[model samples]
Target: MRVLTVNAGSSSLKLRLLGPNDEVERSTDAEPGVDLEEVLRAWPAPEAVGHRVVHGGTRFTEPIVIDTGVRKELEDLTALAPLHQPKSLAGLDAVTAQLPEVPAVACFDTAFHTTIPQAAATYAVPGEWRERYAIRRYGFHGLSHAWCSARVARFTGARRIVTAHLGAGASLAAVLDGRSVDTTMGFTPLEGLVMATRSGSVDPGLVLWLEEHEGLSPREVAETLEKRSGLAALAGKADMREVLAAAGRGDAGAVLALDVYVHRLAAGIASMAAAAGGIEALAFTGGVGEHTPEIRARAAERLAFLGLAVDPARNDTNEGEITAAGAAVRTLVVPAREDLEIARGTRAALR
Candidate 1:
């Protein structure tokens, strides 16, 4: 079956055509001016279109055939993920407008972590907030976590693994028996380790303090935490490459940013390792994890107590296995494959 997988982001749209063999037939990026119709028309007629919906909330636990009720529920989730949901829904509409006869399925990024226990998913909020509002942890980065876990299983033939998907929006996952038992991102993608622009975790008192001292509203506080904090606030830039360059030039702010980012990352990974009882192997996937050798080296340095260390020469290059010969656990860098994952999910749903 030919499947068209759509991953619509806030500012970009990525679409890939996958055949029955699970290989990419064609892939392209569309900008604001690009015609969605022309893009879909260029690909061979797909049997189905699978969408990567960013937030499923509590309504969807698996891939579903889109209908009126499904569409409305998806729309309702837009408030949860304001940045990506609108674009995802628009991508779905665009695909349907072009290929009305083909089946369309919605696969969620939150579905993989649905099995996390209540203890890990809940917060220390009041009972009314916990039970009435569903105010609890709903981790993100599930798609990347799922893909890396499967890849680690295929590569090392191991059942227990820890996969860190570090990028602009970073998160770590603990996979036990090929299932996600715990993860770093929580509730609103802002309750774990620091990220490119999002403040991973902050004291609630800080929000009230800002509100009283600066006369800021709750929405302004949200924007600052989500858009203006993290690496950007720490080092004046969100890109790790720029941050490293500045640090190399002896910028104190940049240096501090790097230290905090790496330290927090290591702490989060250690927690995941503990959750798995002992990590069999560590897989790194995502933009930073796959490309930034310095970050990988630093993170592995912090994990040496666990018998994890990366070979200098191997890490300098972008090779997969960066672990030393005598290391207890393998350290690897695997590029993420979310499009193929979505297509596979859709194929299974069709079956």
Candidate 2:
């Protein structure tokens, strides 16, 4: 079966055409993005279409066939993941309008962390806020984490693994027996490790203080945190390449930015690894994890105490085997296959 996978972002749409064997025949990004109708109009429609829905909330713990009720629930979830859900449903509507008889599946980023223990997910708050408001953590990047974990199982036959999906939007997950035990992304994508623009893990009191003292509205605060912070706010640019170059040229802020980013990442990974008891293998995926050799090298260096060390030469050249021979913990760079995962998930749902 051929499946067309759509991941709709706030400003762009990522797409791929995948077959039953999980190979991408064609993949592309479109922007100023087009809707699903436009996408389908350009290519042959697949047996099914898989939509990447960012937040399923508590209602959905697995992929589900789209229906009117599901659509409404997804619409309601927009408030929870304002950066993603609107565009996702817009694409979903376009596809449903164009291919009414076709099966469409919603694959959620939150679903993979459904098994996260309450101790890890709960915030220190009243029961009313926790239960009625659904205010516990719901980690994102489920697709990438799932793909990398499965790849680790294939490569090492390891049941305990840590997958770092690093990119402009980054997260780490601890996988035990192929299930998510813990993840860095929490409550929202903004609550994880620092990203291109998103401020990860800031004190909630700071937000309330800003609103009370600075007279900033909730929307303004959200925009600042989600769109104006992180590497961009600290170092003048969010692109890692630029940050590294600036740091090499003696930009203190750039140097500090990189330090904070790596430290937070290492800390999160260490925490997740502890949750799963011990990590048998470590996998890196997504844009930064797969492409930025410097980031990977630095990360591995910090994690050497965990019995992982990278071969500097291999790490510099983007080789999948970054770990040195005889390393206690295997380290690999697994290019994320979210498209394939989406296709497989959607195919299964369609059946």
Candidate 3:
């Protein structure tokens, strides 16, 4: 079935028209401020519409055909993923408005990681709070991670893999036997490896102390952490390209920012490898993961204990396998394909 996949990120809104076999027939991107409804109205309605929703909370574990009730439920989830959920909701709304008769499916970013074991999902909070608030790690970037793991399996046939989706937002997924055993992102996107702007895994006590002593409002703290922190706060730029350039110029803060980013990313990779006992293959994906050879080489250097080695020549060429032949663990560069995953989920939901 033809599926129109809607992927709205914090920076851009992309729409892809996929053929029956998931071949991209047409694709277009719009700025964050463009009217998504107009974009949908202009394109021919496909057999189904697939939206890349970032969070599904506990209610949505799989792709669901959209309706008023489901839309309401997703609306309620906006509080969970303030940055992504709204854009996803908007995409759904646009589809419903432009193609009222067409079936639309909500493919969640948290769906793949639903396989994460309970031990990893649970948070160390009060029983009442845990139960009442649904306080647990709900890993994000499921679409990217899911696609990466599948591709890794096809390429190297590795049953145990660590898939890192490093982009403006980053996360690491521990996949074993093609299932997510654990992931770095927890509760929300803000809980894992340092992202472009989001401060990942800050001490709760420190934030509370700052609020109590410095008189910072709750909203202010959230804004700062979500938008003003991470590589941006350290290097005065959130885009890794700028940071890398400045670091190349011997800017101390930029150099430190690059160092910290790589450090946290390498640590996250190791942590995920431990989740699955060991990693047979390491896959790098998403924007920075697939394109930045330096980041990949640096991370692999640190993860040498896992027998991961990056062949500099292959890494520079951005080939399939960047790892040296006969390395215990193969390292790969898998391009992110959330659009195809969304289309697949939407087709399944239609069935």
lDDT of each: 0.87, 0.86, 0.89
lDDT of 1 at 217: 94
User: Scored by Cα lDDT, where does model 1 land?
Assistant: 0.87
Give the per-residue lDDT of model 3 (tens digit) for 1-351. Answer: 889998876667688999988888889887866776677667666988899998999899999998989999999988788777888887667657777888889999998988899899998889999888788889999999999999999989898899999998999999999899999888878888888899998999989998999999988998999999999999999999899999999999999998999899999999999999998999999888888999999999998988999898899854488988767999999888999999989999989
Q: Model 1, residue 225: what's the lDDT? A: 96
Best model number under lDDT: 3
Which pairs in model 2 have colliding backbones? Answer: none
Q: How many backbone clashes does candidate 1 have?
A: 1
The digit string of per-residue lDDT tens for model 1 on 1-351 reads: 999998887777788999999889999987777888888777788999999998898778778888889999999888777777888898888778888899999999888888877777778889987877667777788888898889889988877799989899999998898888889987778878888999888888999999999999989999999999999999999999999999999999999999999999999889999878888899888888888999988998999998899998988765477888899988888889998889888988888
Q: How big is the positional error of residue 23 in model 1, measured in Å on the Cα after superposition?
A: 1.5
Runs with alpha carbons beyond 4 Å of true place in candidate 2:
33-39
lDDT per residue for candidate 2 within 1-351, as digits (tens), equals 888888887777787878667677667776773555666677766788899988999999988999899999899988788777888898787667888887889999899999999988898999998888889989999989998899889888988899999899999999999999899888888887999998898989999999999999999999999999999999999998899999999999999999999999888888888999998899988888888888887887888888888887778654376888778888899988788778877877877
- Minimum summed lDDT over a 10-residue window in model 3 is located at 36-45
Q: Give residue 232's lDDT in candidate 3 (0 to 100).
A: 96
Candidate 2 positional error at 27, Å: 2.6
Q: Of the pair 2 and 3, which is ahead by TM-score? A: 3
Which ten-residue region of model 1 has the weakest summed lDDT? Answer: 316-325
